[model samples]
Target: MLLVLAATGALRGVLDLRTPLVVTILANLLNIALNLLLVHGFDLGIGGSAAGTAIAQWAAALCLVAVVLRRARAAGSSGRPDVAGVVAAARQGVPLLARTATLRAALLLGTAVAATFGDAPLAAHQIATSLVSFLAFALDAVAIAGQTLTGRTLGAGDAEGTRALTRRMIVWGLGTGVVAAVLLLVLAPFVGGWFTPDATVHDALVPALVVVALVQPISGVVFVLDGVLIGAGDGVYLAWAGLAVLVAYAPLALLAGSLGAGLAWLWAAYGVFQLARLVTLWLRQRGDAWLVLGA
Candidate 1:
């Protein structure tokens, strides 16, 4: 999985976004076909679903690596590995690893808390979160753009250009998010039906979906600023900020669970998590410390 991500990032680093995008789309299509074949044709059930996904991801990674190597060869890039450069890159990635770890931990906490509310709430939580993830992936395109563009501009030492790019990306993120929210709102009542036939889960999910819709704009800002900081090589601050947001979120999630609140309140707690991230990133963006002027 990490290899898949690394290959995708490497492609993106060279501004070859279309390759990864096309590769991912094809991989997803292959994944669906394999899942049907393995699960239904082979009768492997849930394990087959997992296997299909793994196979698709591995295929995607290998395809991407081949493309990258082909490009490298075409560019006449042939040399011994730079051990020192590799070490520096690894060091720079550590804080990002930490940040991602903590953020995932918080997500796990939310899932755990949701489970305490019984099967219906847990199912509803799952549906709502799946939608959130789907929307996030779409919105994250803006963040990816921010990451690529911000790095290029800052690497060129164009401070004003970086700021202008940042502003433009933020606005784009917010606008995309608003459109998503509206669509989600319009679809909330019917979406759960597509996922499950259980009336209890379906009804319980509506408010949760509403909560998810309401948080989209906040999510937009959080994702964009996060990418901007990452592009600026400000991962250390991101690591700490992620920790702080997790700390702030745990209690709220726990409180909602203990109060026997439904899925919506639990999701509201997640909103607080996004809001905390927006606050930290907003503050960081307001300063020039992350504006390192060179590659």
Candidate 2:
């Protein structure tokens, strides 16, 4: 499963991820069907789940390959990787690679910190993580929309249109975040019960979820700004800014863990990190730095 996942993940690039996303959806649907058949009918259990996931990943990877090839052909280009092009692409991608690594490390470290708080806290953290992940992925569609549209407008040298589009995207992000927060807040009391049976875990989850709900607006702004910056080709700034955000988050995270403040405090630390991101990205948008016509 991990191997297949890595292969498919490599094909995921650019702001326009529609093809890969559709492939993933189809693959996951197949995985669900296979898991039901193999886990129940064939009695393979956990192994069946792993096998299903692996097959789905492979399917997605294949579909991604097909999509890339088709697009290349449609552009009337030779579908072959050139060494010079590959090297240039790799050079451009270095900062993004570093940024992704740091982000992953922070999340892993956060999970480790959660485990130190005991089973109930860890379980509650998992539930909150799941909810956050779902919301993040959903919100990302809007971010993607912002990225593709903004990139196109800027590339066309339409400064006014780009600004208008950015404003619209920001509004979209704000609106989506607020709606998500309200829904989560309204459902917070009962959501935990759906995920776990232990009263202790459920109790720990409510406040954590409330924290999640409250932070949604902040997260929405950060995520949209992140996509907008990427669209504007601000990779170098983003990479460094991500490192700075991580540095800012580290102290708060350490204090949260050291003080034994549990999941709510930990999430509050995450909120701080997102706030830092929002500020940094907003600052970048205030200048003509990214309006370079040829860049």
**Ten-residue segment with the worst summed lDDT in candidate 1?**
73-82
Cα lDDT of model 1 by residue, 79-183, tens digit: 457699789889989999999998889889999999999999999998988898899999999999999988899999999999999999999989998998999
Give stretches of model 2 more than 4 Å off: 1-21, 43-48
RMSD of 1: 2.3
- lDDT for model 1 comes to 0.92
Best candidate (score: TM-score)? 1
| 120: Cα error in model 1, Å | 0.6
Instruction: Give the candidate number with the greatest lDDT.
Output: 1
Q: What is the lDDT of residue 271 in candidate 1?
A: 93
